[model samples]
Target: MPGIHITDIEAAINFWRERRPSADGFTLALPVQALASLYARMVFQRQDLADEQAFSAAAWAAWQTWYASTPDTPCIAICSTSQGDAVCKGCGRTESEVQYWPEMGPAEKRSTWRRITAEGTAWRFNRYAERARETQRSNAGNS
Candidate 1:
């Protein structure tokens, strides 16, 4: 099983909610860095192509096929709950939401996804800001 890319996971979850089949399976139990390595390996495998433009075109086709087969969401938000937060920091979901995630109707689950996406974007921005600040401070000390 190939490690799951973030983009692939998104595509698979979206495709599942939309009731459409993706071109490939995106379910991977590996960590993000591992999945990134897999993606890098896949890109290298296509290095034999002589035509850059043709290769680019094929890459998109390949991605689409892979995205079609990925599995649905796996976020249970347990780590957050364990930290005493009633709602998941990742998905903004309550304990019930996490427990009922699998049994949820498509419409309800999609609504939950919207909240999850919103929270994820916010979390990403905050993380990026923190990293930038840390880098800046480290550079200041070195200069």
Candidate 2:
């Protein structure tokens, strides 16, 4: 069940839109249209995932384009799974995920990204986030 998540679909749509905005404002680029078609169908069927094997050639090409533009890994440099934690506090990845990430397929990696983002409890989303915000506030106060 290797599939693109709906959020990834939305990202792909945005990517295509930015790369090939409608010239006439009333039409879509072919890549956008192809991905959008799949997006619409997924929405109509209430599916959150687009089956990789089911993608049309055009849609597949479009998705690949978008996928290539994205970061390959979610690592934020900090790792906690190295210290016996089941999940890395930084990236929200399990120890196994950290260890095996380099060998994971695209879909598998994306799936992990989707899960971590949805959970939104990782240090990348919180601890580091708070630190960044504090720095921003401190800088603003200094200014």
Clashes of each: 9, 0
lDDT agreement with native, every candidate: 0.48, 0.89
Worst 10 residues of 2 by lDDT: 1-10
Q: Across residues 6-41, which tens digit of lDDT does each residue of candidate 2 receive?
A: 888889889989989999997999999988899899
TM-score of each predicted structure versus truth: 0.34, 0.87
Task: For model 2, state the Cα shift of residue 127 in Å.
Answer: 1.3
Residue 99 deviation, candidate 2, in Å? 1.4
Among all candidates shown, the one with the greatest lDDT: 2
TM-score of 2: 0.87
For every candidate, C-alpha RMSD to the true structure in Å = 15.4, 2.0
Q: Candidate 2: global Cα-lDDT?
A: 0.89
